[model samples]
Target chain A: MSSSANHAVSYPRFLVRLLSVATDGGLQFYAWMTFLTAIALVGANAWAHQVADGMVLTHMTDHVSWGLYIANFTFGVGLAAGGVMMVIPAYLYDDHAMHDVVIFGEILAIAAIVVCIGFVGVDIGRPDRIWHMIPGVGRFNWPMSMLTWDVLVLNGYLVLNLHIVGYLLYHRFTGRKPNKRWYMPFVMASIVWAISIHTVTAFLYAGLGGRPFWNSALLAPRFLASAFVSGPAFIVLLLLAMRWLSDLKIGAGPIRTLVSILRVTTVVNLFMLASEVFVEFYTGGSHTAAAQYLFFGLEGHNDLVPWMWTSIVFNVVAAGIFLTRKGIEDNRFLVAACVLTFMGVWIEKGMGLIIPGFIPSTLHEIVEYAPSLVEWKVTAGIWALGGLVLTVGVKCGVAVLSGHERLVKG
Target chain B: MSDSADGVSRRTLLKAAGATLGAAAFAQALAPLASWAEGMSSEDFLATHYKELDAEGLKTALKRIEEDTKKKTGVDVHVTADAPIPGVKFGYALNLSICIGCRKCAEACHEENNHDRKTNNSYIRVFEMDKGSIDFAKGTVDYAHPVPQPDKFYMPVQCQQCDNAPCVSVCPVEATWKEADGIVVVDYDWCIGCRYCEAACPYHARRFNWQAPEVPAKEINPDQGYLSNRLRPQGVMEKCHFCLHRTRKGKLPACLEACPTGARVFGNLLDPDSEIRWVLANKRVFVLKEELGTKPSFFYFFDE
Candidate 1:
């Protein structure tokens, strides 16, 4: 290669060339996808008018006050929490191999927060009134309310993480090395913030006095453990997908290391879950009745029992898959294990977490709630929206970091 | 070039003239309220957590309440500055054994709180459960049909106003707090409406106003309590106040008045001869979710 070609290979000049290439077709694809998603969101907003007329437009009734929107919110939060896997490796473990992947995880976190907030807006009858939550303008301080603290912590963490990551990415794109001094403090904060977001969310339900199943002191720990397992599982799947689509490689060694971490976290998650089950059954208190209903299905409310058992089976299977040599080594098997862990966690957290909480309510009543079709569509639409965000975020992140249009160009 | 320059000059002049007039009009609007503006000192309006308010702050707040009531509703409402209930504070006792599940209490609560007429939001929920089933797992609280279904008994649950209210402890802003009177009150103006209190309450006592409540003016109760019945903004949490406005004035709760069977009992627990104390002393009273250790002021009796 000539001297000029070597100069072009330098990170700054390389990024400039990448930018030139991006403007040709890659930028157009990103813009088009964004515009299309924006249009779809507008359509969703119109449908939301019907939801405002009353959840009557949707299939939600008194029995199922929460449906697709809440489930999507739950899933989105899980995805957001998944950012920690990338953070832990790059920051806590000081693994340079995962550094290139960390920025993408931050982008994913931003996308997940958007989806989570969007789903909440759709779930409520009045999205416009969401501003009442803004402090000072409309009574913003409620220390007594876990929901209030949750709102504070989640939004705070989201902004802090996004700013820190975005700052680093921007500097990289501009060919200037970001101040390394800032990175350490931010990395440490990210670790703590990661745990805070998921724990606060778990407390949102666990703090409820009436719902015995959710009110357990184990809720926060269980949430963290599940988040640790599910988050890394998602990152592995994403890395595999990227490798298949492009020349990007998340190295075999780091992948195995992540799998090992996943194995440990999954074991912890299952142990916490088992401990919860044991306490509920053995103590045999007022909460025992709700526990029995969840595990054994009392009085024909067995719909959740089958799902819960399946979730346990899948979790165990996924754990075993990640633990074995062939399972961690084979990319396809790793992907399969990751997918199973994702679904198992979803079922355990979403269905098993929420439904059983309300089963034996404070008044000691079993309210059977099933999501309707409209609820399902709205939910699918939101998930699609989250995927679109991730796609654009990943594209931008890769373009900035790799200094190559080929990685991001449509 | 000269013609374009002239046109630009004209536009700039017009914009400048418009801006001057707008500023003048704004100033004129402010001039009339300049004297009263001193009373509206921004420093005086600093939002404080519920527990942080001092006696002087409370007095000022009470005065502000009276003024606001007079200004907004055109009613001279008496704003009480009394302390919360003493030791034998107000207690609620319900005879679930005799509650026919008429839903009259729900209706009364809706009216008393000035809830949206269309939604008819109520604080109280009466769960009808099958007889001989102690399992809450089998009970269905969400019923489409009307009251008193055959082979079922009714249990009405609302804000227990517990001694150790979880909702009071979790608020980041201290917007909700328990008064000495044993009533859990929320500062509507200070509440961020994050629905944290709703999630924290074990009894599911808290309700969020997702939209600005729309009660008909005529239907609006003129006798408003600052913490209880004034129109709440959207997104903030509200719950049963034990009809604080009426109860504070030595009146019965609207739900108590509406119950035909006289199943609902409300009285000062301090008074030994009070009906609530009598019920507590004699009846087989039970508090919901006792294991949570909330020390609920509300109790249920079997009437046997």
Candidate 2:
């Protein structure tokens, strides 16, 4: 066990100190919080209407069972899994430059998981009866139902990460060295867990043999490849923003490593997408109607055509920029490249990935989906909630590390 | 982070108290909004699962639902939870040769199942396909012209009620399940409305109530079944239960009775001499998306 955890420390006092970190921030921090709070309130209000009005407010028709809510849930899971990239380098290889930022990745995971769970909360039609999924108390059908497995893994992952991040931060605050025994096994377990979270999410789609678009062997790998690209891109962008905001010394080493990971993953992600596209078009069978709807168009309805093409274009542009020497050397282009890759992967991994699976429904009817204003509001609300969580987590972590905050020796 | 002699500091105590008060205030503020929720009631929220409900619970459930229906829709519905008969495995078949695509069966289903009047949601979809082709994509549901167009043939699609039911396997809460008599049913009250079952169904058999379905009081089919065709909650999933309420009692399904051309066939598949068995034995019967291995009880055959 870590000496910090082994010590005679007061957890109640430690928690109180952590609470104080959230309340303490600058003018800019307050403004950011205000902006997020405003969005969250609007979303909360919209959610109220949705709950009162039923899912009718959303554009999900009889044919398309899922919509933007599920797509965002899928994307959030990917974002959460991306944090492990930082974990692998800092813990496995013991990269010194990565040490300061690894906790930030864990913080990001917490934020993303919060958003993921929130999206799920909003997506369901009956929020009150969610307890039916609770094991022991309800008929959970764990081994039989893939959704039950998903519930178990997601909650397990959240608690596991929270424990690791909390243990490390508390130790740092108390001015004690973290014992490897307390955290190393967890860090290693986390690496595997990170892979499982995304893989399990991919399996959620793939196991459904009914939907031809998602029933592919390539889905899990594609999910991982895209997750690596988007996850690191988000961290790099956040690190850059933090550097501009304060005297946080995030060196070029981690940034270079992130870009390197992005470049390779981007290429691999695009290749997998292309390979899937080739197979879908080459077959030209009835099952390929969903792929046809995504790439070209089905009948005269071409809603998703523009979005899919735009995502493909952005992927190419971002990949090209990342490959070039000047792109890496210039901060502006690097930032632009990261932003582009982030959006590209978001589109590819999100709406671009989920919505098409339902189009040209099982009965071969074209029922398109577009998120209504209420859905967008709730979506924005969840994101804002996530941003607020991340901001608070980062503030506490930064303060403890910088020695601006400390535990009382008494 | 320093602890006082008592344990926690004054500031920490105040902060905790303030947070609790803040939470209580938030809940109080949302109470009026909670009152605004129509159709959903405390009783509905506390309704137990179908599998766990005893005879007394089922009796109370039926009585409560009747009262709830009268209160919400101003329609008195007699909802019964009927058990399946032993030695009965229900099966359905449609004769593509005679189906005229008039969509009367679809209409009958909407009324019988208390489906939304506004959306005209039905358990059945009639696809008008080219006479020479069975490609469902090429089939148009909105041909608009008089159906039985000389160039086209009609196929009405609904839940296959698969023996190896994917919909049953995917329901996170076990809200949907296959009955002992081979018909699949959904306990509307227990569903979380995740819609994963809808996605798993290859036939697009399941329907989700995106809104509180409106049915005129006079048009409402007062006779209903708890698991088969009672008015579903706004956020749950519903589908054809082979009209098990009627079928288990030796009555014909709404769709089979509504068929003007006598195309729909249904029977106890376990009975060796049944008409459905005859169709399976003599006709070149086939099921849609057979590669999915759902083992659908519903079959389609051509007599032409």
Best lDDT goes to which candidate? Answer: 2
TM-score of each: 0.74, 0.95
Instruction: State the lDDT at B107 in candidate 1.
Output: 88
> In candidate 2 chain A, what residue range of length 10 has the lowest lDDT sum?
A1-10
Query: How large is the C-alpha RMSD of every model relative to the true structure?
Result: 9.7, 3.3
Give the alpha carbon lDDT tens digit for every residue of A1-410 in model 1.
Answer: 67456445655654554444333333556466555455445436444544333355565433334555666676667768877778887777788888888877777787788778777766655333455467775445466556677677778778877777766765676566678786768777877887788888887777776566777889988888888877788878877777665555557766776788898988999999989888888898677766787778867777678888888998999999988897876777888889899889988877677666656545555567676555665666566677776776676666566664332243
Error of 1 at B88 (Å): 9.7
Where in model 2 is the C-alpha error above 4 Å?
Answer: A1-9, A408-410, B1-33, B36-39
**CA lDDT scores, all candidates in order:** 0.71, 0.86
Candidate 1, backbone clash total: 24
lDDT of 2 by residue, A323-361 (tens): 999677999999988889888888888898899889988
Per-residue error for B269 in candidate 2, Å, reads 0.6
Candidate 1, residue B16: lDDT: 64
